[model samples]
Target chain A: MICVENISKSFNGRAVLRDVSLEMQEGETLAIIGRSGSGKSVLMKHAIGLLQPDKGRVLVDGIDIGRISYRELRTVRRQFGVLFQGGALFDSMSAFDNVAFPIRTFTDSTEQQVRDRVLRCLDLVNLSDVGTKRPSELSGGMIKRVALARAVALEPRYILYDEPTSGLDPHTSTTINNLIKGLADQLDVTSGER
Target chain B: MAALEQRLIRPLYSLGRYALLLSKGFTSLGHFSVYRKNLIVQCGRVGIDSIPIVALAAAFSGAVTTVQTAYQLVSPFIPPSVIGAVVVPSLILELGAIVTGFILAGRVGARIAAELGTMRVTEQIDALEAMGLNSIGYLIVPRIMAGIIMFPVLYVTAVLVGVGGGLAAAVATDVVSTGEFIRGARENYLVFGPMFGLIKSFVFGFVITSISCYMGYYTEGGAEGVGRSTTQAAVISCVYILLSDLVLALVLL
Candidate 1:
């Protein structure tokens, strides 16, 4: 479970998040919907320990994220995966390498194991054939799918999706939403609660 | 009154902001290992990768130094051997440090700033932060580390190639015997010359990396902003390196 308490954040003395709070229980999905610049992403960033609040706390599984040491933060970070708004894949690496990046960085997986896991994630996203392509070569939809595959690569207990369907067609958006719902159902992953 | 206040206060505010950013960059170096692999990649890209160009520049500069020095000392009283002594010290002190620094500013510094600036414009840095990664640790540390390590190596390579080219020029022009040139170089008070060059390289590396990273990390706007950052990285790093070289020479040399 994750809980955020009275988070307040300001940039250049202008408040972006003012006394925002939220909570998510195990196996629950939460959608953070708001207008542009309504502090949705700021709230999510605070929850994930990316930004420390001025006068609040974020507790992940009873541990205050702001109070944790950096070494401990790595452990906290490994527990969740975030699909960025624009699919921040490394431009120089192929999709397969991009998917395998986190596993290679944070785990002791062998090359074969990394490859197998990457292929499995790609298959899950129905992007098996596109593994060798760079992000520039992929369509907008394919890039998002690749980003989703990379986000879920670590089998994270929680996944955060920011504007996941912002640029996709209705059909593709439905497909992604269904995929997220299916992944949550099958893997027992928690998402943002509404 | 308002115009005067704006002129003074705004500039002061900018200066203060720059100081704050410099402090932040210094603090960020503590977690450098988080981006160790990336540093190695940048070192390969910036240092080892720019070897051929640095060598070519050094070689030509060395040949030019030999020719100019020999021409100026056309008097028969001053042996042509003195050219090696003059060239080696000058190369190690000024050309070796400043030229190599400028080359790196143009090559690696601009590239890093542009790459990170693009990432900034594209929101990748924000994405990393949102993923619970320290943007400083993930991005800046590796680059600084690579710069520090490779700059000295590049400096030494420059010195060797430059001196070798100068010697070849001396022999080819029949201005000085090979033995005379080598002996003159050996007798010179440059026992600590390479050490001085390395020290300069270290300072140059820090200046180039910090300035370039600062420009890139704080870039705004879009593609034009990125281009501006790249230009700023190259220009600012070169100017800082040169100014610091003078300061270091007064203090250390």
Candidate 2:
């Protein structure tokens, strides 16, 4: 479970989030809908400990995020899968390797096991053919799907999506929405979307 | 008072930030297994890719030094072999490493800054952190490792090519025969000369890579910020290289 309690944040002394509170429980899909610049992403970042709140605190699985050391925070973060607004794919790597990155970094799986898992992830995202392509070669929607494949490679317990469907066409948007919903249902994981 | 603060306080603040980044990079070490492939890739990028330009700069510097030395020592009593003696020591002790450093300050340093700055702007670094990876250890360590390992390799290349270029120039100019030039260099050769040069190259490599990584890692804004960081990395690396060169010369020589 992720708990954000009365968190306030300011940038350059200008208030962005003021006394915000939210809770995402196990196997729940909670979407924070707001207009642009409404601090939805900021609140999400605080929940993940990517940004520290000016006031109040965030708790992940009962451990205070702000109080924990970076090492501990990393341990907590491993349980999360975050898809950024821009996909944030490593441009140098092909889509397959990008998805395989976390798996290789954190696991001691053999080459065959890694290849199988990467293919399965790509298949989940409907990007099986584009695995060999670099991010620059992939379209916006494709990049997001590849990034989603990467995010979910570790089977994270909590998945966060920041503008996941933004910049996508209507058909692609529906596909992404269905994919997120399906994944949440299939994985039985809590999801927070901004 | 504002100007004074900008001059003194701002630099101190920047220095503090640099030191902090370096400390964090060192402390949050990643597993060797994770970074091994990257280290090899970075070694190829930083060392092997730079050979052509380093060789070109080193060759010209050596050839010019040989010709100039021969021209300056025009005394009838002084043999032409003096040109080789002067050229060899100059190339070994100072010119080879310094020239290679300045070249890499622009080449490797700016490239690292630009690449990392792009990653920063594009949120790749943040993505790495969000993935529970130490972004510093993953990204910066291999580049710095490559720099320290490769810069000395480039230095050796520079000295060898520089000496060969000097010999070629000497033969072409008829300033000294090949035999006399080799004899002159052999007579003046001290083991400390190459040692000092290697030490200088190693330090230059660290300065260039670390400063570039720092500038790139903390980059802000967007495209403009990346451009600014790349320029700053090159400029700062060059400045540090020259400063360290002076210090090394004073202390070692």
Quote the positional error of residue A94 for candidate 2 in Å: 0.5
Query: Which 10-residue window of candidate 1 chain B scores lowest in summed lDDT?
Result: B25-34
Error of 1 at A137 (Å): 1.4
**Candidate 1 residue-wise lDDT, A1-194, digit = tens:** 98988889998799998888788999999998888987887787777776789988999999999998765775787789888777877777799988988788767888999999999999999999998999899988888889889889889899888888888999999988988898899779988722
Error of 1 at A101 (Å): 1.3
Which residue pairs in model 1 clash with each other?
Answer: A29-A193, A30-A192, A30-A193, A30-A194, A31-A193, A31-A194
Name the best candidate (by TM-score): 2
lDDT of 2 at B72: 93
TM-score of chain A of 2: 0.99
Q: What docking grade applies to model 2?
A: high
**Per-residue C-alpha lDDT of model 1 across residues B1-253, encoded as one tens digit per residue:** 9889999898688568666666654564444444767878888987899899999999988888988888898477897679878888888888887778999999989998998998888767765655456676667767877888898988988888899888888888888888888877877957677788889999998789877887898899999999999999999898889799989889887
- Ten contiguous residues with the weakest lDDT in model 1 chain A: A69-78
What level of docking quality does candidate 1 show?
acceptable
